[model samples]
Target: MHSRKPFYLLVALLFISGLAASIYRGIEHNVPFLPGKQVQSWAVDAKVRFQATGEPAEVSFSLPEDPAYEVLVENATSPGYGLSITSDEEGRRAIWSIRQARGQQDLYYKVTLIPTGVKQILATEEPATPEPYSWPATEQAAAEQAIEEVWSRSATNLSFAQQLNKALTASERSQNIELLLSSNRPAQLFVRMLNSKGIPAQAVSGLFLEDQRRRQQLVTFVEVYHDGQWHLFNPVDGSQGRPDNLLIWDRSGKSTLDVIGGINSQVNFSMLQDTRSALATSIDVMMNNDALDFSLYQLPLEEQSLFKGILLIPIGVLMVVFLRVIIGIKTSGTFMPVLIALAFIQTTLLTGLIGFLLIVAFGLTIRSYLSKLNLLLISRISAVIIVVIGIIGLFTLLSYKFGLSEGLTITFFPMIILAWTIERMSILWEEEGAKEVFVQGGGSLFVATLAYLAMSASWVQHWVFNFLGIHLVILAMVLLMGQYTGYKLLELRRFKPLAGE
Candidate 1:
């Protein structure tokens, strides 16, 4: 039955674990705070009304040129109101009017706009487009001419041109012209050329799908205001400066184009001005809300005050397991050393270790001298405790005198543990000699240092805090330590002669 205790404990834990999982899933999936699917788009209704004193009020309504599929004006009821559809210098407008209300009369008009297309328009601006020009027939002559023209251009006006001239000249002279032209950097040179010629041009960063492979294309599109309309120009492919196969933006509307630069290629282009989807935003908010709710429930009230202290337990346990199972370090009690180490974490390891050692050493020294008095073990321990306290007081006073308040505070040093260690060390010193006592005391301090390091590690703290499920990590460590059947390092050293066979 004693041997079956662990099995029953494990079974009970498993049942509780399954229960917790089911509860979590139920809450996370069913609750509004938890993340589910995203809401894709929003339906908006906008209405505008106008009233004039004597004359008929003229009002216009226009919709965004974005290709939203569902847009309608519904329940637009205004008695004795005039409505007209008109085309203006701008694309289109709906005109309506209502007589002035004596007091405050309500007019009802509802216009609904729903997004129809996958791609949304982002921006619109009018750009100057330049005429198409061809490069020299041969690649070599074109490269040379491009370099010369770029270098002769005005420095103030064509900075990009000058830089491109230097780069192209170096590449051509080295016979690496193909490598340079194949890259997207040359698009900047194209932009410089258009800008120098008084055509508004800029380089655009976007992904391009090609027949063989998908590539990132940095193309320069020139916007020219000509013939009372804005046009787009692409000099790289000699596209005759048209907006048809180019994505360009001006003050007017966002435009996107799909182009197939190579022969026998089909390209499709789409644009989205508003990058974020409503569903994605909603899902993010839900996930955050759920996480906060889970945190509020998972943390226990009693442990909340010493939350940081409780967090150090796994690290301390790991150190204890490593010392006992791997290194075979023996201290006074199981887990007592880990608890002591945690106490050390409150006051750093170095200061804690130094203070601990000093107090223990002073108490043990006093204990040995008082052993000549032939007192009982309890009385002897009591006397040692008094001496330890006196030594702590002296140490505190000395620290203050030396302006070391930080160091002195550690002198308080869990007095009970210090007194017990002193008694144990004195016995070991007397019976087992100085070496055994030093080894055990030093081992305890070494274990404490390891625990301190593990507790302080940022990654350990992050994992433990973010995933309270990491208590499973501690359980896993416990299981691994239980199954460790190998000989300890100390045992190997002591039994070295057995290995010689």
Candidate 2:
């Protein structure tokens, strides 16, 4: 029992060290996703300088056409005169100026570049053409042409297809559509049919009314330009296709009365397209932002490999503590049983347990039989060692003969530990009784099995891996265990009669 104090002290120290290390890692050692071979952009203000000796150098500056209006070029010269200009990319520039220099004097110019916004556009499509058309009539004509084009390409004359396609193609110059079908949402069928004929169409997933209750449904909508307005089509029930129900809200954010298309007929209308409200668009933006944020910190090289397993050691230690201090299990060689259990983690609990039990059982039987020969203690252990080797050799031969390569790996099962355990158990059997030896051996195995289970639990793995700080939870557990002075559960069972008095 006095020896047990050192074990408890060792456990306490380990707990404190683990707690400190985890906290240090959480605060000081951040495992960030460091930027690799990827391009990153930032907006900055810098001064531009140019020099021309005998002849003036022709310098031209350009900026990305955006809403912020921050691009400014200070100095520009043709033949020793300063010039300034402001225009858009289609027009001229926000601000461009020129400075004149003759003899090798450096001209100082400042440019302020501001970021308006960044958009990730698919590379599959070419840049949109910037062409303006007359309002009202132009918009009406374009809408009609787009609808006609879509109708001509579509295989189904269903009212839903006609209305949806017409709306989708209305703003051909501004809108691009890709069609996809999803079995989960039948409404996508209409979208796919329209897209098959070269109409830009896609299935939209959102909540729609079904049977008077608000429920999730996929709606097929199309982009349309009408009356100088770009709108998304919301077609009501018709021979083509119609959703069971629809909800509407005006531009003022007021909810409009629910539109319940008659079983036979539905309303045909268009809505303004807001990419911000699109689920897919929003998800893509979030993923990209998170990816970029992660690509900023560097993690340790050595930790990169062992990080996962190292995080799980706390649970393994907890299992060891629970077995020793709570369940009152006996094990030979402090932590050797847990280490064996860790080896089992590599092979898996069921197979490892079975293999270990079989090997130890066979080795113990050989050791017991040799004990009848009156061999010396060391000689008896050595004889058991030889028998264990022979058993491993036999197992390997049988595994190879039967094409069970898995069994061959168990041949490497820490033969020395097996020999030592058998020798110890034999001593216990002789000095105390077979029951005492069996109880202790069984207790060690029980501890190992518990350790195995704790290490393999998914939630345990996830929490330990994601939030290293949570290791303090394990530390707290150890601290609580340290103060536990009550008899262990097994000891309570043994002392029950005394307590009953």
Candidate 3:
């Protein structure tokens, strides 16, 4: 006479938590609710070519830095050189050094990146301090005059940058603008002027992504620190905000490539865009987001594949519960069908069914003979276990001899479960008569087949493996069903005569 309120409340809480967690994972991690969803990715290849001096050579190249995108993979092709990745205040760089080199040396670095749909504002704990500027008197005068003019025409830091960029690229520019452009790059001068006015700014390089493009080089952009976050602006046209296809390559205001012992060194990029399954991208996102600590994906690939099959057990168990509790279907051993369904996953439906029937039938014949010995219960079960193993081996050998390769999978069946099943059936036959044995045996087979169908489904496998919350939901459903006290569907047939009355 326990209160059912607590039971119902527990079920509701479990269901809600499971459903909410699954929805959050789908939206937050970009995991597709369904399989086969596609996500865009880009692969960029950088080729560095230079003439060697027959001496020890060293080359350094900058790596991409974009908070809006996640790097999926990266590697370098340096046959004779030692490659290593190093990071510093400047940023991450790939350095390749060789003991001795002569003539033309070619090096290649490649990377694949996927958009994360994250905002690209750069935030720092403390406001950046501007670097000291010491140019020649004429250049200093020019920079100061240009800054004054832009300051007079602008209010905010962003507006001042826009005005200065416009003046630098004007159709008819002023004398100071011409002087600044003669000796300095546009983006570099723009940043310097912004910094001289006590606004922190830096010149960064970005690549405008285009499909199937080759021999591409990085373009410079100015990043001005305003309102506590760095905002990107195209110094060429003063267009503000980061572009959807722009990948920030270098933000350290340093050289992208530096060769210590080579001449005429250059790096050119080739890029291609493609699409992949959203599931694959989700793994990358999880790895980048440090979600692997709680994810099955963190397991080695072999273990992950093993769990994929193991995680389907609950689906089979759920099917068994529904069939037995709601429909009053009698099964030999409450969950033996679930294990049999697991075997079916390995051996496939037809082969597993045939193998199961052959082994059980052969074992039952031997089990009947053992019943005459009047052995102890434990000893009787042990004898059946050994007999079940023998039956499995004999059937497997026969299948192989007959060239039925599918029978090899019979080894995957749980031998102890089969032995216990045979023992139970033999006891049931002796006590309940042969007709009752067939009824329960057929029901077991029916339930196992249905469980196999449910567990082997593609969508079911995807959801169970990708989202652990599904197991919780299944647990809730099973618990709720356990409390049922209503009439079974099969039992209702006994009242058919009353309908006519």
Candidate 4:
């Protein structure tokens, strides 16, 4: 006897691998397991305004970067100016240059990103020793005293920096704390103090994102090298780690915007937060990243849409298998219901059903008349196909004349399938009478309707399209159903007398 073990093993493998891939994509790519989950996306617009000096002019604007978000799109708008984007160890920058410019000038930069809600940890290469700041004599004395006091209270570099920030921003500050705050910004002082103690640190600019906010300015945050990575801290509140809504825009410790040969140069930001389909947002994020992902989302829009319908066929096939093997439904032809159900997706349920019934009814009438002509099998089938097309065209014209636009979609049905179906039913009618034809035809329609309902569901479409691995699970199910050799559900009634005996 042949072993069923190999078949079961293959089925288990397919099921497990398909489930794992789907779950992994859902978690790693931020794709929700269900549909309609919304993701927050931010649209930021930066406006750079300055007065041109009627000579050559150039402006460099720093771009935003954060590990918590993935940028989907970035663009710049500057008329009559050459724009060049450059990326380096520092970060990305947009440079706009123009010759013989005059009067006021405005350059705009726009970007869209979906936040991943992951915290940012600043990382950099080994840093060179920082140069000592040239502080005034009294201020210098205060600095040393403040650093020594904060150092005594803390052990590690992160703790030391946090304590220094706490001391600088305290409400009731000491004499040295007051001296330090009077001369420098809290973030700058925090970094200088950390550097003075031989720790690597820098003052970076972070933007606090708010919905529908205009004229937004960058806030200073201190970054200190600790435990092999740089950590961000709020100098004002001594809070460690990055804020969820705060975007680190400038980390180079340089000016965020620089305009040469222009006066009163400044940059202003406006941002709006919106929600979008989580799946679409996740797909966009994956496309933007360098990670290896296998998904239909990578296909072109047209092909992706086609695949959306194609992928649904397996679902209809599964329904057909269950109905035929387990329920003992007698379809006119195997797999025909799946094609009909797919057509129903385009033409919709009620309209497709009505259209299918009318086309087959008319085609069978014409086919019955042609069957008496002694035509060859191929010629008869080909003639039936032509007759089906004519019947559909006639129905469409009639539908349009009567203002029934849905009937126009009847053409979406496969003409060849309809032809073959009509020919089979006609032949069945001649051999076994009309009752068997109706039984098979009705069964096919019943199966197709059920399949259509399953395949057309929003959640079903979302899963099948987003997760191709699911088809394997469906295939395994169909294969397992193929192994069923017991009496069909409809055949059980014939054994009722035997059971009673």
User: Which candidate has the highest TM-score of all?
Assistant: 4
Candidate 3: stretches off by over 4 Å: 1-13, 16-38, 53-57, 79-82, 98-103, 129-155, 163-183, 274-291, 294-305, 362-383, 433-435, 494-501
Each prediction's whole-model lDDT (CA): 0.54, 0.50, 0.90, 0.89
Residue 475 CA error for candidate 4 (Å)?
Answer: 2.2
Per-residue C-alpha lDDT of model 2 across residues 217-297, encoded as one tens digit per residue? 234443222223223445323222223233211211111111111111111222121112122222233343353233111
TM-score versus the correct structure, for each prediction: 0.45, 0.42, 0.84, 0.91
Clash number by candidate, in order: 17, 16, 0, 0
Per-residue lDDT tens digits of candidate 1, residues 107-127?
Answer: 333433323332433324554
lDDT at 11, model 2: 64
Sort the candidates on lDDT, descending order. Answer: 3, 4, 1, 2
Residue-wise lDDT of candidate 3 within 1-501, one digit each (tens)?
888898899999999999988888899887888888898999999999999999999999999878887888899999989999998877899999999999999999999998888766667555667766776887988778778888999999878877887888888999898888889888878877888887888888899899999999999998888777888888787688899889999988899999988999998999999999999898887887688787898889999999998999999999999999999999999999999999999999999999999998999999999999999999999999999988889888998999999999999999999999999999999999988889899999999999999999888888999878878899999999998899999999999999879
Model 4, 36-87: lDDT tens digits are 9998899999999999999899999999887777898899999999999999
Stretches of candidate 1 exceeding 4 Å from the true structure = 1-305, 483-486
